[model samples]
Target: MVNYRYLGNSGLKITELTYGNWITHASQVENAQATACVRAALDVGITSFDTADVYANTAAEEVLGEALKGERRESLEIFTKVFWPTGPGGANDMGLSRKHIMESIHGSLRRLQTDYVDLYQAHRYDYDTPLEETMSAFADLVHSGKVHYIGVSEWTADQIRAGAALAKELRIPFVSSQPQYSMLWRVIEDEVVPASREVGVSQIVWSPVAQGILTGKYKPGQAPPAGSRATDEKSGAKFIERFMREDILTRVQHLRPIADELGLTMAQLAIAWVLQNSNVAAAIIGASRPEQVRDNAKASGVEIPAELMTRIDEVLGDVVERDPARTVEAGPRSR
Candidate 1:
């Protein structure tokens, strides 16, 4: 069974290895495969699921809802996000304005076949909308019992501080911070982690395997293998290009011995590394296949030694992206 942790200061406990359907559901695989993966996650005791309305234009949430049908809703935590363009791409179709946030939540609940989601997140910091307006909308959802908790994704530390302050005044549970965190991407550590800690927010990290880079499947100085994310031009390839350099690949290969010494697969090692952080309430793992879920679930309780963690940092060296500015840079400048 997977270990569980409290999300921020909230009483709600989530599986440390939560299932996320980002690219795998609806877009990358068929419905059957996606459901099989979800079943595999349940088999491994993953009770927390993360999704976004923008994923496959809201199809991912529907797939997740269908897959999770018949399970006791009380025993699970279903999370979804707003703040991205879904449905028609109208001027008001996206962002964290009251109109979009309110409309988006209703559509998400309808598609998800759930009356309410456990955690409703702002998928990104909407620069165009007033922070007070966005937070007010979330507060209304919480008060109406449509959303249980609130979270944000990819917001800067200052942004989190501002939101958390507003959430405090509104008296809503601002519990989790969703960010891209892995061995390769350390952008959140410098600022976001500290701010979130102060504001009583824990991390629910995405891409703990760094888009499969830490899995040691992509060899240095060679073309990517067939059917890999790197080969998929439409979806995953662009997100992974930044880590495809020979030098980074070579450094990634160096972590193989550390994983071997730990008696874990590279993917397990990568996931475990993120869970080692106390602030990380859960690390979201997405899978295209059932076996991938089973394999990643093993990372739940594994603990890497301090010396090995140091060695991992040494091995990866300066290749790690520790810039705090990257957090803001990664978010949208408009909308």
Candidate 2:
């Protein structure tokens, strides 16, 4: 079973390994497969789920809702995000503006088949909308019982500081952050982690496997295995492209002995690596098959030793992306 961690300083405790449906829920797999994956997560004691309204253009939430239908709602932590175009790309369809946030929550609730989500997150910081407007709208949702807690995904350190200050003023729970974190990607370490630690916010990291590159299945100089995320152009191939270079793959192969020593698969080693961060409350894992969920869930309780941790850094040395500026560069400049 997966262990639990408190999100930030809050009373709520979530599974250390959260099951997120970013690309696999409705877009990459059939409904039956998606539901089975959710079941596998449940069977392994994962109670936290993460999703976004813009995933599969909103069908993902519906599928997740149906899959978790008979489970006890209070026993689960359901998180969803706003700030992307869902339902047609209209001018009013995206961003963290008051109008979009307000409308998007209602649609998310209706599709998720729940009265309130455990955590409602801003998918990204909206460059065009005033932060006050966005936080105030989120405050309204908390007041109305539509959302239990608030979070943001991929916001910069300064942005998190500003938002945490406003959240304190509004008296709403601003408790979590979701960022792309993995062995190969350490963009959040320098700035975001420190800022979040100061503000009582914990990280719910995504892509701990670097979109499956850390799994050690993608060879150094060969075509990606058929049906892999690297080949699935519609779902996540573009995201994995950054790490598909021969040099990166060759360096990744160096970590196999480390995994062998630990008796963990490369994927498990990668996921365990991120959870070693004290600020990370949870690492979100997505899966297309039920067994993938089961396999990755084993990473939850494994503790990588200090020397091996150091050696991992030594092995992946220059391949790691540790720049804090990449956080800003990765986010959108305009709504």
Candidate 3:
């Protein structure tokens, strides 16, 4: 069985491996498949779920609502986020302004068929709106019992500090922050990770496999596999370039031998590597198929040897660019 960790300072405890609607939403995976995958995820001890309002045009929540008909719902920690445009040609369309935030939560609750969300995030830093306004609004949600705890996604470490400080002053409970983190992307290490650690805000990481590039499935000069997320229209044409750059590709390829020696799949190794960080409260994985969930779950307790870490670091150093100690904007997995 997997172990659970206290998420930030909040009362909620969650399994290290969480599932979310980042990819396998109702818009893509069929209803039966989504149900089965979610079931498999829960069976293996995943208690936290991450989703966004814009995922699948609101269909993801609808599907999860249906999936959580009765008994199963009580055992889950449902987390969904706001802060993106959902409609157009109307006055009230998007953003984290007080008006939009208030309305968006109700809409999310209605779609999710739940009274309260375990975690509600800002999705992105809404610099246009006052931080106090946004933080206070989330405080209101907690006050009214519509949300259990508030969180922010992809905001700069400074932004998180401002929001967290505001919540502290207002006496609102803020628990976690979400960002893109994995073997390849370590931008959070610079400031976001440290800021979160200092403020008692645990990190919930997305793209734990570096948008699947770290899985070693894509090779040099090879065509993308059919029906893969890399081929999706939403992904920019440069998706392959940014991740599978010659140097990055070489490093990703090198992991294959390490994975083979450990008798684990590349996907499992990628996930296990990220979970090594104790500050990582949960690593949200997106899977389109039930087997994919099972495959990822197999690495829950697999340990990596210290010698392997040396080789792993050697391989990572060759491909990883930018300073882990430098603070910068998050990657595509932001919210």
Q: Which candidate is the best by lDDT?
A: 1
lDDT of 3 at 256: 89
Candidate 1: tens digits of C-alpha lDDT, residues 32-129 = 99999999999999999999999998999999999999999999999999988996689999899999999999999998899999999999999999
- The predicted structure with the larger lDDT, 1 or 2, is 1
lDDT of 1 at 263: 92
Candidate lDDT scores, in order, read 0.95, 0.95, 0.80
- Error of model 2, residue 216, in angstroms: 0.4
**Residue-pair clashes per candidate:** 0, 0, 0
Q: Rate residue 199 of model 2 by lDDT.
A: 97
List TM-score per model, in order.
Answer: 0.99, 0.99, 0.93
- Please give the distance, in angstroms, between residue 132's alpha carbon in candidate 2 and its true position after superposition: 0.4
Regions more than 4 Å wrong, model 2 = none
lDDT by residue for model 3 over 1-335, one digit each (tens)? Answer: 65677899888898888888765677668988898888888777787778888787778888877776674566888999988877662565667889889988998899888888888998887767788888888989999989989898887778788888999998988889888787887778778888888888989888888878888887767777887766876642344457857677777898888999889999888888878887888888878888898889887877888788678888888466446433343422222
Model 2 Cα RMSD, 1 decimal? 0.7
TM-score of 1: 0.99
* Model 2 weakest 10-residue run by lDDT: 326-335
Ranking by TM-score: 1, 2, 3
Candidate closer to the true structure by lDDT (higher is better), 2 or 3: 2
